[model samples]
Target: MNVLEIRNLTKKFGDFIAVDNMNLSVREGEIFGFLGANGAGKSTTINMISSLLRITKGEIELLGRNIVKESKFAKMNIGIVPQDLAIYEEMSAYENVSFFAGLYGLRGSLLKERTVEALDFVGLGDKHKALPKSFSGGMKRRLNIACAIAHRPKLIIMDEPTVGIDPQSRNYILNSVRMLNRMGCSIIYTSHYMEEVEEICTRIAIVDHGKIIAEGTKEQLKSIITDTKEIWIGVKKEDALDLEALKRISGIISVRLEEQTIKIVSKAEINNLNWIIQQLIKDQVEISSVEEQAPNLETVFLTLTGRNLRD
Candidate 1:
């Protein structure tokens, strides 16, 4: 079943269109990875879907209800964990989760039970009375998650839930996402950490300039760069090579210098390594080693959006 549907979704800030006309459908019981660079329309789209921001144009359906018109109903079925910490510093862990759960119409005995379940699920049951001000970065992130999931919404939108936390905390949150999905909650997960997305997402959609540039499984996305073998060459730090001239070579799609290393991104089927070597020798460049490499998600992101670093 499609848990969420977005058709022609767009958001604009006066003359600047943050999110162009976009469409996407997320399936039930799947971890959907939403990836993009800073100001790439990722947050804009997310805000619209969560009904936190008004859409200039487009349609969003969550669990069979229109989110714009039926805002309250649709929101009751959705949970949002913002990138910033939403928990209060003075509140105890139990108080934090209970407080957020109460805002969702949960109350009395039920709210109390759900709070305990959420805290325990996040491995913070033992620290229920501890204030968030005393928690570590990872623990605080976990508490942020516990608060978001206390309502057991059908779909959870997590934005950089593991940012700035230790690896152990990151792993715990990733596992918690999987656990939620197993319990029948669909997830929209966004992170700058590509490997975490690759590890957990059943499907992925990458956005740029407010449009979905690519959507598919990890292997499917990598297939877009067919027969593209990255060639790496190491040379002396003082070696001077003509970058523009190298880029002009046939089958050499891109050439750039990373420190003392010259990296060439080219198609393996048509790239002539021998000719490249000949040109290098003529240029009086000392060669250390030449290696062929396969493309990964990072390379694909750089190829599409030109921003490899996650914001």
Candidate 2:
């Protein structure tokens, strides 16, 4: 079952179209990775799903009810852990969780029980009476998560939940996300760290120019961008390597000499390694070793988006 569904969704600002006919879906029990560079309409789409922004056109259904028609139902079923911390420094950890959970209609003993449960779930049980201002960055982030989950929404949207935290805290949050999914919550996860998404996301969607350009498992996404392969050849002296000569080889797309290594991108189906080795040997370029590179999530993101870093 799909926990969230978006069809031909769009958002416009005056004449500028922020999101253009976007369609996406997140299945129940999935940690779905939503990726995009800055200004790619990812945030706009998310805002519409959460009912924070009015959709200019199209439909978004959360758990089978159209969000526009049933905004209360949609919001009740969704939990948002914003990239920006949403906790109050003045409030005790328990009070913070209780406050947000109460907004969703949790009250009395039930609210207190869930608030304590959430604190324990995020490893903050002992600090229930502590203020967020006195906490470490990671602890604060975890508290941010506790505030979101205290209500136990069916779907959770975690936007860069690990940003600016220590590695240990990052790992803790990642494990917590897995635990949440195991406990029957569908998740929509976003992160600039490609490795994090690769490690935890069940599937991923790449948004560009206000549209989804790619959607698949890690291997599937890699396959789409693997028509070309990179072979890194180590040489004794980089200056002696002729980049032009390597580029002239059939099926070779591009070549560059970096320090003591010569990088060559070629058609994947080509058998030009032997010829390239022979040419290097003939040119008296001492060869150390050669390695064929495999495509990873970072490779897919850069290849598809034509970018080195996200804004």
Candidate 3:
């Protein structure tokens, strides 16, 4: 079943369309990875889904109710963790989480219980009395998550929740996301870290220029590029390599020279590594090492958008 549904969802500012006619459905219990380059309309679309921004034209349904019309009913079932820290530095961890819980209509003893649970869920239970001002970067990021999950919303939207944090904290956040999904809360996870997304996400969607360019499992997305491979060759003399001649190879797609490294992309199914080596040998290029780069989520992103995921 789809926990969240968006149809023809669009948002426009004057003549510029921040989000085009977007359509998506997130199945229940999925850690949906939402990815895009900077200014790709990902934030705008998510803001509209959370009802923080009004949609120019479209429908957003949480569970089965229209979010814009039945906002109170829908918002109660949604939690948002913004990219920036959304906690009070002066307030203790418990009070900060309690405050957000109150916004979702949690109250009294139930609110306190849930607050404690959230704090512990993010591994900050002992630090409940500590002010956020004294916490490390990763702890602060985890606290931001604890604040969002205190109310136990059915759907949690996390925007770059692990950015600029230590690996330990990053692993904690990623594991917490898995725990939430296992406990039945759907998540919308956005990040520039391809490896994390590739490791944790059940499915992914790539957005660019206000539109979705690719959406599927990692294997399905990779199928879009067909069977492609990248080979990296290190030569004793970088100046002696003939890049133009290499580009003319039967299955060679492109050739690039990065310092002493000659990066060659080719159609994997048809290309011959031995033939490539023979060419280098034929050209009198001193080959020091030959390495084949594996195709991965990062490669898929670069193929679809013609730019790096971080770009």
Candidate 4:
């Protein structure tokens, strides 16, 4: 079942259109990756979904109810962890969670119980009494998450939830994302970190120039660029490589000699490996190893959008 459905969703800023006729859906139990470079309408779309901005046109449905018309119902079912920390610095960890949970209409013993549960889930149970000002970057990030989940919303939208944290903390949050999905919450996860999205997302959609340019699983997205393949060739002599001649070879799109390895992007259907090796041998380049590089999510993003995720 789809927990969220966006049909012809459009948002504008006077003369500028932020999101243009966007159509998307997030299935229940999916950690859906929503990716776009800066100023690509990604944040604008998210804001509209969270009801932070008024839509200029189209409908956004959260669990079958229109976000604009039935905002109360939508808000109750959706949890948002903004890219910017939404917790109060002076507030104790417990108070922070409780406050956000209370906004969802949780009260009395139920609010306190859910607050503590969220704290424990994020590994900040012992720090419940401590203020967020004293917490580490990762802990604060986790606390931000704790606040969002305290209300136990059916759908969670996490915007850059793992940014600027240590590897351990990032891993912790990634694991927590998976656990949340296991517990029956559909997630809309956006991150500049390609590997994070690649690692955890069940399906992904890439937006560029205010429109979705690609949408699919990692492998499925990679398949869109089936015309090209990347190959890494290890050589004993880097100086002996002929970069220009390699590019001139049939089916080879581009070539680069990096240190002791020659990187080549070529036509996927071309049988030019032997030809490349022969040309390299002619240049007195001794082959050490040859490996074909599989296209990853980052590759797909760059190929489709013509820009890096962080660009």
Candidate 5:
């Protein structure tokens, strides 16, 4: 079942259209990555879905209910962990969780149990008494997540939950998210970190200039580009010849010599490297080291948009 659906959703700020005719659907128990560069309408899309910002035109349905007409009901089942830390510095971890849970109408023994569960889930069970001000950047990020999930919402939307945290904390949060999805929570994960999305997302949608340019699983998206494998060979000596022959190889598209290094671009289906090595051996061309470059999310982004994701 699709837990969330956005149809022709749009949001504008005067003359600037933050989101344009956006349409997406997220299935239950799946970690869907909403990917984009900075100011590419990721936050704007999240805001509309969370009901924190008004939609200029279009519809959003959560759990089969229209968000605009049934916002209270829709929002009640969704938890939002904003990019910025939303906890109070003066409050302890326990207090912060309790405060946010209370806003969602959780109380008594149930609230206490949920608070402890959330704290433990984020690896902050031992730091329950620590104040936000005293915690490290990672600890604070964990606390922010704990507060958001204390109410046990059915859907969780995280906007760069691991931003600015140490490697340890980032791993902790990522694991927590995977665990939550395993326990039956649908998640909308947005991040500028391509590797993070590639690591965790079941599927991803790449948005740019207020539109979705690509959407699919990692392998599916990578298939959009024909040349998935790149080979680079380092020549032992600049005097070594056969560079022209390498470029003319059946599957080889282009070959360039930079000093003693030979860069080769070829069709992914062809084992061009092996073929190149064989030809070089026949020509007695000196070779140093050979390496294959596998296609990644960054490469896919560049191929489709003609620009880097970080740009």
Candidate 6:
């Protein structure tokens, strides 16, 4: 079953088109990663789906209900964790959860139970009475998530929930997301951090300039690029290596020397490292370290957009 369906979705700001005739479907119980560079219309598209922004020309359906026509019903079933912190600093964690839960019509014992459950799920059960201002960056992020899931909505949309936080907090957020998905909640995740998307998303869609340039599983997306393997070899300062000889290797496409490091780009099937090591041994080139760069979502994004994610 398709939990969300967007057809010919277009949103414009005067002469600039934010989302142009976009169409995509997210399956039920699947973690869909919505990826793009900054200002790529990722937030705009998500805002529209969450009913926080109006569509200029198109149709959006949530769980088989049209967003424009049945907005109240659609909005009620979806949870949103915006990119920025949505909690009040003066309010305690318990109070924050209670407030958002109340918006969903939860009350009395039911509301209290759900609030505690959400706090515990994010590993902040002991800090229920603590105010947001007292929490660390990561803790505050967890509280943001707790408030969003207090209602247990069928679909959860998280936009860069782990940005600008310590590794411990990032891991906490990632684990909580996994736990939620295991409990059968569908998620639409948007982030410039390719590693996070690669870690949790079952399916990914890369959007650029208000359009989806590519969409697939991690392996499937990597397969789109022919050069899948990247080799980095650190050379000692004293090695009298012949650059021309290294370039003569059959599978080796290009070689560049940066300081004491040498980078080799090649096709995915080529075991260029083994051959390079053998040749280095034969030529008496001093090899300090040889590491192969694994194919990642970041590489795919760079190849597709011709720019870095943070750029």
How close is every model to the real structure, measured as TM-score? 0.89, 0.85, 0.87, 0.86, 0.82, 0.83
The top-ranked prediction according to lDDT is: 4
Query: How large an RMSD does model 3 have?
Result: 3.4
Better of 1 and 3 by lDDT: 3
CA lDDT of each prediction against the hidden true structure: 0.89, 0.90, 0.90, 0.91, 0.87, 0.88
lDDT of 6 by residue, 27-130 (tens): 99999999988888899999999988899999999999998999889988899999999999999999999999999999999999999999999989999999
Against the hidden true structure, what lDDT does model 5 obtain? 0.87
lDDT of 4 by residue, 1-311 (tens): 78999999999899899899999999989999999999999999999999999998999998888999899999988899989888899999999999989989999999999999999999999999999999999999999999999889999999999988999999999999999999999999999999999999999999998899998888899889888888999988767677999989999766666688887878889999999988988999889999998988866776677667777
- Where model 2 places Cα greater than 4 Å from the true spot, the runs are 231-290
lDDT per residue (tens digit) for residues 138-189 in model 2: 9999999999999899999998999999999999999999999999999999
The list of candidate 5 runs beyond 4 A from truth reads: 227-290
- Of the pair 5 and 6, which is ahead by TM-score? 6
Error of 3 at 10 (Å): 1.3
Q: Model 4's lDDT to the true fold?
A: 0.91
Model 4 misplacement above 4 A? 232-266, 269-290
Instruction: Put down candidate 5 lDDT per residue, 216-254, tens digits, no spaces.
Output: 999999888756566778877546577788777878765
Ranking by TM-score: 1, 3, 4, 2, 6, 5
Q: Kindly report which residue pairs in candidate 2 clash with one another.
A: none
lDDT of 3 by residue, 255-289 (tens): 77768888777887875778778888888889899
Please list the residue runs of candidate 3 whose C-alpha ends up more than 4 Å from where it truly belongs after superposition. 233-288
- Better structure of 3 and 4 per lDDT: 4
For residues 1-311, write the lDDT of model 1, one tens digit per residue.
89999999888899999999999999999999999999999999889988889989989999878998899888889989999999999999999999999999999999999999999999999999999999999999999999999999999999999999998999999999999999999999999999998899999999999999999989999898876767889887325677777777888867767788877877769958887888788788888888877787776776777666464
